[model samples]
Target chain A: MISIRNLTKRFDGNTVWENVNLEIQKGETVVIIGGSGGGKSTLLRCINRLVEPDSGEVVIDGVNILSPGTDINAVRRKMGMVYQHFNLFSHLSVLENIILAPMKVAGRSREDAVAEAKQLLARVGMAGRENTNPADLSGGQKQRVASARTLAMHPEIILFDEPTSALDPTMVDEVESVIRSLSEDGITGVIVTHDLQFARRIATRVVFLADKGICEEGTPEQLFDHPTKLQTQRFLYRSRMFEQDLSPETLDLYALASELRAFLRRYEHERKQEKLLPVLCDELLYPVLKHPEAPAAGASLRLLCSETSSRHTMMIGFRGIDSDPLEEPYLDELNLALLNNYAEFVLSRKKDDGWEVCIQM
Target chain B: MTIQKTLQGSALTVAPEGRLDTITSPQLESELRADMNSVTDLVFDLANLTYISSAGLRVLLSAQKAMNKKGTMVLRNVKPEIMEIFEITGFSSILTIE
Candidate 1:
């Protein structure tokens, strides 16, 4: 459905990428992955003329979208873009955000746009939040609303630029799941992201950009598991190690605690900081373990550790605990003080069958 | 878990040892209930107590609530581990700890 021929881009006499060629088929989900400053996002922008390429053509259907006389706004209307920071209109409510483009640009009636917007909001799991302001919503909720706004346009192709990059670790899954569901519905999508796990989940084809051009392109399994290029191998291996560092398998309470201690020590050593693990364990995990309702054995607790560009986080999930561990009623002044002193941010949410407590530092 | 109780004058002290879990919290509750009527000061010596669950917390809450009307309740020698439980669950403010 889309083809790029000899596409090149440069900034301040520096070549970002050159001679990039790729063919994207209808209903295909493609992901562009590369190291920082590789112009993965710049290439995505080049598709809709959001970033004008120095050379070459981006053809959708049969016409070159980059042609001088072509209608850029009309072309952009057919393509939806979801941004890293959500890019929601700060002044608009969720419903207004979704309905504005369709009503203003597409000439749809207000009632019609609103009806469609409600359906899109429900589809993205934001049914009752339509009246809420963007500032009032969480990062995850804003992203979902941004997606619904994009879908409200009813575009032929959607572009996602690191959509979950700005989200907290707990919020990443909800947004990823929404995007995954959209892919399942056969929406053609091109996403640029650093999240290897999310890239693997939604991609039908993967493209790696390095050294000012397209370095490799293959199925996700081929690119991630057995890349032929050295650059691809190195990138994938390093990201895989980082992911592994965060996800230790489920273990008994004692074993999990010990492993967390070791993990914290390693983290502190690597970052050259004082150890925060003992305090975390003392204030968080120990209480859960000693709580009479705690599960006795076997996958009772799960630990997820993630390090993004801006934050290092650990999420400890407790299953089979009947009460909410982080409920406001249960938090005393000391609990709040201890959490504030030890972590950058603390959030708790109830999952389908368990409670997840996330501590970010 | 095992419970040892001693009554001296108007004060009653109970020391519990081992895990205070769902299976054992009821034992502590019944023990507290049996002697709470005559006592004006309830003291828990938790030095030997190793663990506590929500069920144990419920018992403590009930004891604290009962003591609120006529008596004073204090927890002494709480291990660091047990102290953490109180902090996490917000029980530290509700129950006096020494």
Candidate 2:
């Protein structure tokens, strides 16, 4: 069990987060979700004393590791961190990578470390990659080896700092699956990531960090589907938009509308509102569905909708298109008029293959 | 998708059944291209169309552009779902939907 009481941190006079109090129960997978540079990773680092906190206590199992005379290395040994970039020794083979920590840090014999490393590699689904060098392996494979190395330490808690962010889209699921398996095995995990879908799948609890501390914390369903706080809702909405932009896919219009309606109904239920559906559909959903972009075959238009009591956010992402539809001269006036009338703000940006239009009302 | 054609006077009606997605849009495009020159009025009967993606919209845009010079293009019995696609892409204003 880890308890953070009034944990605060600052970097070169800029406060990252202040007075952040949170409790990670044993075996609970707590995911920290927030905007970039909001101290999500810093909170993880502070827990392991990698970035020393400005003030406050980081107590793990009644031991205040931040106190003077505390064995910081021993405390760190209890927490394993998997970085955004696979911080593996490129010169070391996969087997060597995993065994190095156990043999040197834990003082285990090379044979014993090798045996454990093999098992950890197998557990992380990298059994046959023992002889492969880190440079020779793919990003996902290297991350797997990194995870295996962390597991080699047999830490009670694993801190993941955007482990899948550096991976290719195709390889993200593989690493995520590995992390999911760890949660199933009852490992206490503190994951700081922008991957909301992954967090929803693996997190036992979700913490939204904003404005110097935790703005909201709840179960993934509660936080994602119906976030009570404004910051939580905005962060979730933006995070989903980013995810859509990265891997856009063609969506059935009817199915998407149905999903949006269902989401709105759930949101209304959480907010205890009556008669919000009709207004949302007519005002927000209808206008968003009206934007025109001519995408080539196999291209996709992805949509995401999120609403709070006072405002609504709709994100439409277009990908794999041959030409930018927003560049069409005929659409300039119409898009401007639509934005002026229906949305409080309309932001459109060029993406990899297509464009993204975000409408907030 | 199954396409049914009915010719009356100078109008040619192409009725497409099922989804007009990325895979099927070209089928509709080629079908229209073959007869578009002869027809003065182009009508798309979308009663049975269950879905339309950006791919489908592109074909429709091209058809509308072509018809603007020589003929009048109209989309009839447009499903709310398909209509939403038109509305989303600003195709409703460009293409006459009834």
Off by over 4 Å in 2: A239-299, A303-361, B1-98
Give me the TM-scores of chain B across the candidates. Answer: 0.97, 0.95
What is candidate 2's lDDT per residue for A239-324, written digit by digit as tens?
Answer: 23212222223434345445545654543233312122222233323333333453322323243333223334455555545444
CAPRI class assigned to model 1? incorrect
Task: Highest DockQ: give the candidate number.
Answer: 1
lDDT of 2 at A170: 52
Clashing pairs in 1: A291-B53, A292-B53, A292-B54
Worst 10 residues of 2 chain B by lDDT: B81-90
Indicate the worst ten consecutive residues by lDDT in candidate 2 chain A.
A272-281
Instruction: List runs of model 1 lying over 4 Å from the truth.
Output: A239-278, A285-308, A316-336, A347-357, B1-98
The C-alpha RMSD of each candidate to the native structure, in angstroms, is: 8.4, 14.8
Q: What is the DockQ (computed on Cα atoms) for candidate 1?
A: 0.05
Each candidate's DockQ score against the native complex? 0.05, 0.03
| Model 2 residue A272 CA deviation in Å | 47
